[model samples]
Target chain A: MALDQSVSRRRLLQLIGGASVAATAVGTLAACGGGGSGSSSSGGTLKVIGVGDQEAGLRKVLDAYKSSHSGFDFNLSFAPADQVQTALRTQLGGGNAPDVHVVYPGNGSAMSMAQLAKAGLLADLSSQSWTQKIPDGFKGAFQSDGKTYIFSPGSSMLGAIYNKKAFATAGVEPPTTWSELLSVCEKLKAKGIVPIALGAQTPWITQLIPYALVPGTVYAKTPDFDDKMLAGQASFAESGWVDAMNKYLELQKKGFFNDNPNGTTYEQATSMVATGKAAMAVQVSAVLSAFRAASQTPDDLSMFPFPATDVAADNWIPAGVVVGIAVSAKSKKSDQAKSFLDYCGQQENLNTWAEAVSCVPLYGDAKVDPALTLFLPALKANKAVPFMDQRWPNAEVQPTHFAVVQELLGGKTTVDAALKKMDEAYRKKA
Target chain B: MPAVLVYAVVVLYPSIAGAGSAFTDWSGIGNAKTFVGIDNFKQLAHDSQALGALRNTLLLTVAIVVVQNGIGLLLALGVHTGIKSRMALRLVFFAPVVVSPVIVSFLWKFVYNPAPDAGLNAALGAVGLGALRQDWLGNPSLALWSVAFTVIWQCAGYSMVIFLAGLEGVPAELHESAMVDGAGTVARFRHITWPLLAPAVTINVMLSTVGGLTLFTQIIAMTNGGPGYATDTLSTVLYKQAFVFGKFGYSTAVALVLAIFVAAVSFLQIGYLRSRETAA
Candidate 1:
């Protein structure tokens, strides 16, 4: 009887195991089936996904396109910046990306035009008429291996977005030099206003201060710094990056930034500056609308280049091509998506989108946002460089830069160790 | 036979195919992969980030298994009595268990806001314990514990329900006889209740252990393993390797190791706990 009971017990165990496995398998299939439903191209509606920052321009253009051309319908959605790196990338990897989706310019991110185009995941946009009109300096951002893959409105200036009211309260104007910036910050602090609102908790936010600084400290001194780094002739630890990082820390030591920056978020910092609790934040012109919306006095805000050196002439700015859209190679409605992109490239639509986002139109001579007047001279003087990560070989360096900056803000790592970590990340295979 | 076929097609095939990627260098996109036998595993062995994540995972598992289950048992015992409000107490305690982990994490994130005038800090000041205020999720040293505390707060109720079921199964006759005799409540619990509760203890321990070892959603939702990777676990590291760093093969290797480790731990724990149950 004991022998019989043991045999039955073994069989019962097998039965339970098989049932559980079957249930799990069915659940997995249901999940996989559900995920593909959103990307389907049925009934001629083009599926579109964009980052939140692109919504103002992207949605306006899409709406205008729909009104002008009947049957050019689109299903538009926006993902937060961080979610795009994961959710959209997963869709791309799974070969179920939307008909049109956001793609960052240049090569330093997983969802960048170069990376996706190299994977044969993005439709070639080289045949579009506007591809030929891309400025010579901005060609590298739009093209990978001589093929255009993404369409962007224009370059966005990275600088300090300040409240005129806050600056006036402290009796200071936007500083034109590093020493002047320090004096202005001291004045702002004396008036009990935070000089700078650094939101290091948001990973992408941590890189802006460095981006605002590196144009002068690294690129201005060595125009071919990216080329030398690519050739293994230069490193972040040995270059002007050290001075930039030291200046960054020097500002912190002087208590210019808001308290516990690593704990603060981008929205919090934006609110601080908008409410005049803080004087300024190093930010991109693309987000000027967000800052304006957060303030009761939207007209009080304007932007100027964040000074990086004591010499006013050395204060170069970062003006990189803004995040843009690409047609997925796997989309069944590629033609429709391409047409929409082409529509976006028309000078009128380009200017409209650029104006909505407060960026410079890519190829047109249009009136730019008035708040960006201070940085245009630098752009005209060729004192501007593309965002540093745009030239990085791989995605790792950008995230490592973000992490090290947070570490620096948290007092968890020194500049030397932080730069060393970045150097190590830079050496990784792309 | 149909179930077996479905299982093979849905579960076995994809799992085995995915496991094969561990020996290659796939970048999680495209057909560009190279066979690089065990290179990922070798790299993982020396990877400081992965090592640190492992340490975090183990620490979290131990803390959850001990503290979560301990509080659960106490709650179970407290609510098992004939108190007039026992059902209401049980319902209140088990409420969080029914809510989604993502929702719980987000709610707790707001509670841990670092500003002195907001969330937990304000509450601390209200209670005259202002000195206890901290940058809860922002401080590297405190982030992991804060995440752990959230997980515990949300899960202790689950353990309580399981222990409550075990408590219901304990024989009331034995307690009654002991009460009539020279036995007190503590003596009866030590002699009769604790030993009989061994099976419930075993189940709670195993479940909490596995859950803690695989803790991902809370940490990701709260910290994204930030403030310099102080809250990262093996799961988040593997996720970042695949999605963020675009190293799919290395991520798969890490996943396979984590799977094998969890399985081995569950097996050993079940074996030891089952024997203890039988001995009890």
Candidate 2:
């Protein structure tokens, strides 16, 4: 007991000492740094750690904000995409999480904003007006109960991004509907070009095909899909999710995708479509910048939301996803953080974000880039959904989805078998 | 014992913590941790995805151990012929072991690409063997073999080195006496050469078995265990659960099973090898 007491006492002292040192370092950084947390009384820095793309945009936005308000400085640090989550967990575990960060809650991803909130790591921004202003449809995807954990600047529309030039040269138009998309794929293939660039080797890339179709399946075939599945009132078989899997299988059968599509990577597909070797690919709007960066000109590529079907009820299904931002609960500068979130809600910053990233702003009158016009119809229709894996019950669903896609492509498991495996996987605790 | 204790804290504790988590319903993180005993493991019993991973892991461990050790022992014997070119050949054979798995994965990924433009497919076509070309990493029938080949390639040399070290330690007088006793090469190898290389066999078998079973980085970088779970292993399953799907408890359970598996196999190998040494 004495040894235990002494050991714990030493640990407590060490923890307290560490905390004091951190507080002092933050103090020193705040004193010298000019990043403003909007409502800062002593003028402190809002340390934001995220991917290079978001960090860069945040820095640009901060630069503009700094032009108007002289006190705020952003002590910006970034990790490449792969390292972000691990870095965040390490920092947060050390009681020094970034004041601002991005959260992606797909399968296997950590630092999910909701998971953070569930852990009491997120600031309670229930009072934030912008959180309330989020569209009702989007609120469920972002907030749990009545509390907001993250603030996403813009939402993404998932679909095929193709080279307009290549399509025109091939004497083909981009697919407007699912059948038409397949038909367009056939035509592209006839021209001795690879049709769809399916990056199946990257499990997540395989996910986009089904993710783009989830809304249609739910909204069209079974309106009660989400509720029924959650309530145990439905299974994957009943929901036409199996039908979606069959369609994926048919694509493999038709040879509409690249040969050994499972061998291609997300980046390789982006390169293929950008270079006009492949006609189309199903990917996220976030990939637009990457596609653009890979392309000769940003205008060379364009997006189209997943093709509409005959079901009228499917009109509400948007092929887009939501990414929100939330403040950390343990932050000392909660008031300042809330004010900054409010600032993000302002039209100026929202517009700036839309312009910089070619993103669809969730609120305010931000203009969509001309290139993203193909997806405007769906976005305006209010049919958007968050990434499907983010909404799944367990982590297994994400990889299960990957496995199913691979099987569907591989000719090993039938659609029914694969979907059965998926539905069963969802019940797993892990 | 203290050093081992430190290792237990650093390593074993996390595993035990994972096992504890498997009993609870911890969704990655949070204070709302719920206790639901045996639920995660129960879930695994019904999980075909986890079952697929288990199958793949077992298949891979078996194949790589048998194939890698077979090749390694063959090469060790083949090259231990006391030739001047042996040094150069050793460098060539062991080269893949030093290259990072990530770089090798990229190289093999290209080789596995089934497209007409792919190097392997193009070469097949050039050789009039187009029909023989397969989507080595994309076809469900082939993905497992594709990854296993890479594992064997990378690890066979390591096994060879272990066997080589063991082979070099064998007394030349024993082999010469066997030869003088009218023993042929095959007879000498069967009794003396094989029996003495037990330590190397144990080490090589254990190392390759673990390497094949755990199976990360290369499989992930090369194939991400796709073509419909054809290449999935326990580590990949554990990863998909904990990190991807936010099922920390269940994923940790998978990890615990893997740990126990590695331990059991190691124990068996060591015990078998020690007995063999005593028998000799």
RMSD (Å) per prediction: 15.0, 11.7
Q: TM-score for model 1?
A: 0.93
Best by lDDT: 1
- Candidate 2 segments whose C-alpha is farther than 4 A from its true place: A1-38, A41-59, A62-97, A105-111, A126-132, A221-224, A310-321, A330-343, A378-394, A426-430, B1-18, B123-128, B177-184
DockQ score of the complex predicted as candidate 2: 0.46
lDDT of 2 by residue, A1-430 (tens): 2332112222322322221221111111111112234354335787766665465356667677666666766676776544454556656645777776666532224566555655677776555556555544445445554555566666666777888877887798766666777778788888877888888877668878777676676555554455566667877865667666667777778998887787677778888899999888887776677788899876889877766444533633343334445566666766666677767777678657645665666566445555556554444444454566655665456667777777777767677777777788776543
Q: iRMS values in order, in angstroms? A: 1.0, 3.1
Predicted complex 1: CAPRI docking category: medium
| Candidate 2 chain B lDDT trough over 10 residues, lowest sum | B240-249
Candidate 2: tens digits of C-alpha lDDT, residues B1-280: 9999999999989766657987876666555677888878888887777798889889988999999999999888878987989988888889999999989888888887777757788899999999988878888877888888987888788888899999998899999999999999999998898889988887787788778778888877776667777888888888766655556777777887788888998888788878887787
Model 1 chain B, TM?
0.98
Q: What is the lDDT of residue A104 in candidate 2?
A: 56
Q: Worst 10-residue stretch by lDDT in candidate 1 chain A?
A: A25-34
